[model samples]
Target: MFPKLDPILHSELRLAVMSILAGVESAEFSYIKKQTGATSGNLSVQIDKLSAAGYISVEKGFKGKVPCTTCKITPAGLAAFENYVNSLKEYLI
Candidate 1:
């Protein structure tokens, strides 16, 4: 029997964040918040989790004196995102 797959990247917000990061090279916090329609607090928390997991890299800097945070999906994150898609296929079929 196939092993029970771990349920990771299942939350809607986190998934959204991952999906967005998957496509972009790197995006700023405001860009993600605008694209995902997620609140600042929620996005911040999720990004922190991904960063801690080594799935994403987070950078903080200034964009013309404005505070900016950028997020990029690491190779591990891409792999997990692919696995997440495969897991959903199990449910779909």
Candidate 2:
């Protein structure tokens, strides 16, 4: 039997966000939005979910006068992502 996938990272948008963070030290909200082609409102909601799950850390600050939100994956998140990938591989066998 295949291992269960993480419901939080299962979302396409949330998965996309995690995938992006998995490769980098961090990413700005706008960059994630641009890469995922997601609207600000939707992205914010998804980000909140990830943050609430302790899968990602969000920092709200400012680039000069403009507000900025940055996200980074936590160790727990990386483990979860790796586990998710391995579990998904079970389906291919």
Which candidate has the top score in lDDT? Answer: 2
Q: For every candidate structure, what is the RMSD over all alpha carbons to the true structure, in angstroms?
A: 1.6, 0.6
Residue-wise C-alpha lDDT for candidate 2, range 1-93, written one tens digit per residue: 677789998999999999999999999999999999999999999999999999999999999999999999999999999998998889888
Model 2 TM-score, 2 decimals: 0.98
What lDDT score is found at residue 86 in candidate 2? 91
Clashing residue pairs, candidate 2? Answer: none
Which residue runs of candidate 1 sit more than 4 Å off their true CA positions? 1-6
How high a TM-score does candidate 1 get? 0.91
Q: Model 2 clash tally?
A: 0
Pairs that collide in candidate 1 are: none
